[model samples]
Target: MEPHAARPLEGRLALVTGAGQGVGRGIASCLAAAGATVAVNDLAPTRADAVAAEIRDAGGDAFGLAFDVTDADAAQTAVGDLEIDILVNNAGVPPGGGRPNRFAQMPPEDWQLQIDLNLAALMRLAQLVIPGQAERGWGRIIQISSGASSRGLAIGVAAYGAAKAGGEALIRHLGVEYGPEGITANSLALGLMEGVGRAGDPAVDRLIRGVPIGRLGRPQEVGEACVWLASEAGGLVNAQVIHLNGGTVFGR
Candidate 1:
């Protein structure tokens, strides 16, 4: 859709974390295309700037904001002056960068790292953005979670799953508490995406066979979903986890 063609998020500003590549980049691109001025964030300045430039090259408004979301001081400094109407908490990773480690074998430090990045950082960003949103009488908080969140105690990703579940739980509470204030909170529990889950890989192929869609999801699809949820049409939804897996799993 063209930016001038009845765009729902025109005049809004959105902050998308970890937006340098993959799913975050896709979300940022879509939000900009939907007429939202996007704050493209990444820990790396170059990556953030690149994505922002990509949006601008496509005729959308955007600017890069580089800061580690896990660093409270940095995050505050980066976002304190901006009036963000939408916050997309998409920065996260499992311990060892998604390498599998059993719960019993995982160290406490690893567990803390998982929580800090996956759960604590989310709350921190929400804290920074929600108050301004409340003052303005509108806001949207969207979490990019994993399918492991609702799967319940998976063998190799116990800590990661737990942290994601905690984030979802927090979203539910925020939805109920802030709904009257015109703020909506929800989570998009993802399955596998193109780069993240390749089709030719043996394990991914096995997983794809089980998926009713018979393919890995594209990042733009996730982006489109974020656009809808951030728009007025998705206002009725709150405190809910919308699964984006291709029928590989179901229900929150």
Candidate 2:
């Protein structure tokens, strides 16, 4: 990326959920490196603090915010205290894809759990952040979606796909409703990537086979993309879901 496009995040505050590990941590670090004051949030209380410490050690302004995003009111209120200009909803658990009873014995509750975490809560959080963004007249909300959202998904992940698609729709709607308020909302439809839960499983092979790039993606790569979209360079870009699936699905 060009130097100017990267520097727009200077002094901005970015709050990332599930930031204790994986893609969330990567996004937080990258935003901090790009000059945003990152607020690293996660369900693991200690881990969030640890990452925040590391960021501070690197001379980046950051702090830990540990809370379950499913608690809609609490999550919103906690983030409301921060001076966040960017929001990254990266929290969710991975469905083993194909699982229990060879998919024949899947429980109704199990399926609903995935949707609640992956999709429903995201919609709530976006709504939570809107008031702050609109008041400021500038904000960036970036969500981490999934490649599973494209396929029927592995046996156990039908619900995951549904949730992710819901998230994508929510993001697009937010873009339309809030872009005029100077708040840009977008999603990074992630490809298979190392470090993500379940990425190492052989079941991922089917997902990878279709990739033109023929490789796993990295959290830093997604992080860099977030930096771009959050920058002024991406001002005109809104409501677009950028699928970072290494040519798996182009221009979705």
Candidate 3:
């Protein structure tokens, strides 16, 4: 393959969760554009198929797989036969039903939901691919985290925040354990990205004002970052959290 060919990820296989729309869909499309055959996983079969069709229409190889990440049996059944070179864990639920609420008022089920989907489910999916990745001597695991994981920017997201923080910790641990085997793991802690989560909420304007960049982040920006991190150019960058919050928060 030519060094600068449009398909740098040619021959690779990637799986992106919650790729029916929003940030997940963007990342899936970007991966496919780089020449990877992509599996777009989403809870809704129709949505997943739509996004996958879009990728195919754009001349990229893609297919939709529907399964709830929190469902272990379903996840295993959907992903068992695939040889995935890249994994992007982007499925998650917004805190308090997309509205801020006091932690005191948060329901127990809400907290457990976040923990199961954002953290535990991620581990389950990673387990399916890490062994193969280690044996093959190459793999990329990217987690889509939130600014709340490390910052106080948002309110009433204690459960979500805690879950994401745990996810970041897991990424660091995975990096250390798998780095020598050529499997890199990292997390992207994003803030106020356009069209993602509750970006259109009235409270978002206040949040955006605090960002030094003076604007909401674009989904495409996140997608490009994923492409780089999953490519050879980012081989040495591991066990790190790349803040995509437009400088809203600094440091780990």
Return the TM-score for each candidate structure: 0.94, 0.87, 0.92
Candidate No. with top TM-score: 1
How many residue pairs clash in each candidate at the backbone level? 0, 1, 0
**lDDT (0 to 1) per candidate:** 0.88, 0.79, 0.86
Runs off by more than 4 Å, candidate 3: 1-5, 94-100, 196-202, 250-252
Residue pairs clashing in model 2 are 97-156
Question: Higher-TM-score candidate among 1 and 3?
Answer: 1
Q: Model 2, which residues run further than 4 Å from truth?
A: 1-6, 94-104, 196-210, 249-252
Query: How well is each residue in 16-130 modelled by candidate 1, as lDDT tens digits?
Result: 9999988899999999999999999998899999999999999999999999988999999999999999999999863236655798898888888889998999999999999
lDDT (Cα) of model 2: 0.79
Deviation in Å, model 1, residue 31 alpha carbon: 0.2
lDDT of 1 at 81: 91
Clashing pairs in 1: none
What TM-score does model 1 achieve against the real structure?
0.94
